[model samples]
Target: MEATSSGRRSKQIRAKKRIEQLKAFYIHLAVFIIVNIIVIAGAVSGNMNNGQSFGEAFFNFNTFSTFIFWGIGVLFHGFKVFSYNPFFSKAWEERQIQKYMDADRDEMKKYS
Candidate 1:
């Protein structure tokens, strides 16, 4: 049937979109890790050259700040990729649709 084929196509499209999202998330994670490692390494080396101890250099705020900030972005990206919206879920969408439909019915009743 046409409806069955359309449903299958819709599912395929959604699956493809999900795969793309996952791929993008992985790329983002890789970049985050690689860049943070470079930044932290530079910070540590610079600090040690300035006479700081290894532990002090490695654990400095400046050394880890990039990781912390970029990690926040990666966390948000993960949430988006994983479809982790708590507020605007399917139930919320259905409720909003029903609410609007009820409002429209009430307005039509007043006109009739």
Candidate 2:
């Protein structure tokens, strides 16, 4: 009797994890936008009596401007990955899955 390979299963798990990560990233974006809106709204309702510039008062997504640069970065990365050659992208994922499968096969062979 032979044991079935778990590569496909492992790939599924990896894909699921990636999806969750993507979802979390989008959630962060949503929160950021909403929070910024509230902040800006508060600033708008109040007089500009604070001893700081507008740029200094609000959260900026710009890299040179704030830490939000990373969020902007991976957002574009996700955009480019989705926009350019989706077939190639899927192929890359499949290849990753197969590579995991093959590694498992090799390991099992070594044990047997």
Candidate 3:
């Protein structure tokens, strides 16, 4: 009974942690959108004031550069929050652990 309760508590803790991660990700996304909008707006206004057309002001690299660069960080944060690690998954970690353990065992055999 105690073990079951402990397991349930652990599950609750994990759920809470997941909820917090999701909340943080959402907040990050909101900030990213808000700040990028402001930056793009400012760039557009500044470019237009400098004699550029609306099309040139709104569609230029400088207008979207912040989004392009900071977007990569936001994407990585979202990936982490969502547990979408393509480079190092649980299976990959398990394989790495097994590989190291095998190496240790081989070293022991060499000594024995």
Candidate 4:
């Protein structure tokens, strides 16, 4: 009975945490998407389209930078170059979990 209850509690806790983490992840992703749209729109509005070459356009040193190109390119990558996680990365997942846990503390305290 004791073991069963402990397992159940653990499962519940894990589920709650997972749900919170997903919420946080979605919130971050939504904001990122919105920001990306705005940035792209601004660039387009300013007639910031393609350059002389694809390389020059992507690695715009006189503008954003090649570093930015790599940064965005590898936003969801690690270990291998081609095979990589993009949206919800391991580091990103942990960060979002922490963010969610922090946000839920007050609500948790109320229950406690």
State every prediction's TM-score relative to the real structure.
0.84, 0.43, 0.91, 0.44
What overall lDDT, based on C-alpha atoms, would model 4 receive against the true structure? 0.60
- Model 2 residue 55 CA deviation in Å: 15
- Model 1 clashing residue pairs (backbone): none
Residues 12-39, candidate 4: write the lDDT tens digits.
9988986776666566556666765666
Q: Which one is best on lDDT?
A: 3
RMSD of every candidate to native, in Å, equals 1.8, 9.2, 1.3, 13.0
Q: Give the 10-residue window scoring lowest on summed lDDT in candidate 2.
A: 58-67
The weakest ten consecutive residues by lDDT in model 1 span 82-91
lDDT measured at residue 19 in model 3 versus the true structure, 0 to 100: 98
Q: Write the per-residue lDDT of candidate 2 for residues 14-112, one digit (tens) a residue.
A: 889878867876776777667656656566334234554565544323312333554476566567534555556877989999999999999999989
lDDT of 3: 0.97
TM-score of 1: 0.84
* Alpha carbon lDDT at 48, candidate 1: 97
Q: Write the per-residue lDDT of candidate 1 for residues 1-112, one digit (tens) a residue.
A: 9999999999999999999999999999999999888999999999999999999999898899999998999998998898787879988999999999999999999999
Q: Which sequence of candidate numbers ranks them by TM-score, best first?
A: 3, 1, 4, 2
Which candidate, 1 or 4, has the higher TM-score? Answer: 1
Clashes of each: 0, 0, 0, 0
**Each prediction's Cα lDDT score?**
0.94, 0.63, 0.97, 0.60
